[model samples]
Target: MQMLQLSAEAYWGVIAHAQAAVPLEACGLLAAVQGKDLVSEFFPMRNAAESAQLYRLDDAEYLQVEQIADARKLRLVAVMHSHTHTTAYPSPTDVRDASAFDPFGALLYVIVSLKHVDPVLRCYRIVGGQISEVSVEVQW
Candidate 1:
């Protein structure tokens, strides 16, 4: 299994964004320095779908975040979104969309579940319509 390393701050940032979004799904991007597996930056993005069950990153915002990552010599390591009422696992739509958008199988798909009393965060790799969980290691 693959491992995803994230800073404590970045981990909490994802939770906070999920909580703040409330009924709507929150979306963002995670970036890491090239050649490193540790995630160093989080870019919260606008959800173009603006729905509780669906999310789409705004194109303009996506480009902006990509440029920012490029400037920092970082690569987009993952795409993150919150599930207001679903489990942390990928939904069918997520699987379909990920396969289409990430055909190269380069990006991790992180899902934050707000359905339970405590929010749950999980990471996955979706390629060719197959989904596999990835372990997350929070670094101090």
Candidate 2:
């Protein structure tokens, strides 16, 4: 499995928090140094799901991403979320939402599976709603 430069501590922290938000859904965005391969910032979003139907990031969240990129001198490299009862891979709804929503096709989609024994984190690039895996360097 591939890994992202995200700090293990931070990643696990977010995972635990996300998993705790179970049954509904959790969402967040990641800010990292442009091409540096390390996550430097994390922005969590509130789950606005109405019975398993998740809402896309609203305007405020989108604006916040731009601000973080500017302030941290990093690009909005990835968008992350947790899967409550499924695999780490994107679901049909996820793909559909990514196609119609994700602003930058350049950003990676990171999915964390809270249902497994050890949480599973997977990253992908969504192009026209087609997800392609992207590898990163991470340590155990």
Candidate 3:
């Protein structure tokens, strides 16, 4: 299986962002060294959809984050979002919206579900409308 190595700070950042979103789904970007699977940074963004069930990264925020990543010599490797009332799995909407969403081809998708007391995070790769689980390797 494919693996996504995430820094502990980045992991917590994602979780905190998700928790802050509360009723609405949270969303963010993961940055890594070009062509690498290691996530070195997390960039939290406002959920444009503003819905409890779904998330949409604001286009302006996305561009700003992209520029920040580029300046840091990192490339955006994945998109992370939270599911407030559902499991940490991609929804039909996610599958449909993810295809060709990244100009750099398919992107890793990290979903955090706050449906339970302990949040569950899952990784996936959605390419050509197919969803495949990816192993998440947390790095301290």
Q: Say which candidate scores most in TM-score.
A: 1
For residues 37-137, write the lDDT of model 1, one tens digit per residue.
Answer: 89978899888999999999999999999988999899999999999998999999999989888997999999999999899999999999988999999
Worst 10 residues of 3 by lDDT: 98-107
Clash statistics: count for each candidate:
0, 1, 0
Colliding residue pairs in candidate 2 = 3-136
The lDDT of each candidate is: 0.93, 0.72, 0.89
Order candidates by lDDT, high to low. 1, 3, 2
lDDT of 2 by residue, 1-140 (tens): 13457766557656875776677667878777776767866777766562333535656877876886788787776788888777878888888888777645767788887677788888888878677887754544
Candidate 3 local lDDT, 95-118, one digit each (tens): 887885753335799999999989
Candidate 3: what lDDT? 0.89
TM-score of each: 0.97, 0.82, 0.94
How far is each candidate from the true structure, as Cα RMSD in Å? Answer: 1.0, 2.8, 1.7
Clashes in candidate 2: how many? 1
